[model samples]
Target: MNWYRFSDLAIDDDEISMLRRVHIYVCSSKDLEPESAGGTEIGKMLFHLYRQGVRSELGLIRMVTEGEPPPAAEAE
Candidate 1:
């Protein structure tokens, strides 16, 4: 299960550039209890918004995964 909080560009003159940096925070849990399921639900909701093109770039961001080194260290 995962919990996600999504924030995108707000529709207003003041938020034009300020809102472009959409933020999505996801809390992942392996538990199957009701509470954990709730977190998963939240992640799904954020994904739905991404598919619907809600944000400027749909919350795309740089990600680093286990065992994957940084690009600078990658052999050419």
Candidate 2:
């Protein structure tokens, strides 16, 4: 998938799909704690997407990501 700066403001469907896939892959695992590194990154990305006006369900994403840590800067 392609990546862009937040200022670019050109988010596409593939990028959004990738974000949802990441959230699903991370959130669907029973063994994965919501506070884990992987989970934190998912939370961070979903938050970013919501801020960018792309979201399937804000309530559900927030439920898993609200208290989790943001992703590392390198991920940006």
Candidate 3:
């Protein structure tokens, strides 16, 4: 669902789908608590993606929205 757009990196269709699922899980699970489960899970996923070099427009948007820095640029 195209959750984010930044510069030239667009999160792939699959990642968008995953984000939608994450959103749904956060929205529906009252037991989990948004801050604890939802926030942590999403944060972990974002960090993992950043480390794996999966930087994308969607990911960058997520970072900014969540008050995070964009992934580091590759070394020259």
**TM-scores, one per candidate:** 0.29, 0.37, 0.31
In the predicted model 2, the residue pairs found to clash are none
Tell me the number of clashing residue pairs for each predicted model: 1, 0, 1
- Tens digit of per-residue lDDT, candidate 3, span 1-76: 6544473465567866665555445334323554576666755665466545755645544552465443458899
Residue 46 of model 3: what lDDT?
A: 56
- Residue-level lDDT of model 1, residues 1-76, one tens digit each, is 8554454432455433423232222332222332366555644554456455544432422221224343355566
Best-to-worst TM-score order: 2, 3, 1
lDDT for 72 (candidate 3): 56
CA lDDT of each prediction against the hidden true structure: 0.39, 0.63, 0.54
Of 1 and 2, which scores higher on lDDT? 2
Candidate number with the higher lDDT (2 or 3): 2
Give the per-residue lDDT digits (tens) of candidate 2, residues 1-76: 9787775766578766756665765576434565778777766867676666664565545555567665446744
TM-score of 2: 0.37
Lowest lDDT 10-residue stretch of candidate 3: 25-34
Query: Which residue runs of candidate 2 sit more than 4 Å off their true CA positions?
Result: 1-26, 29-31, 58-76
Clashing pairs in 3: 9-57
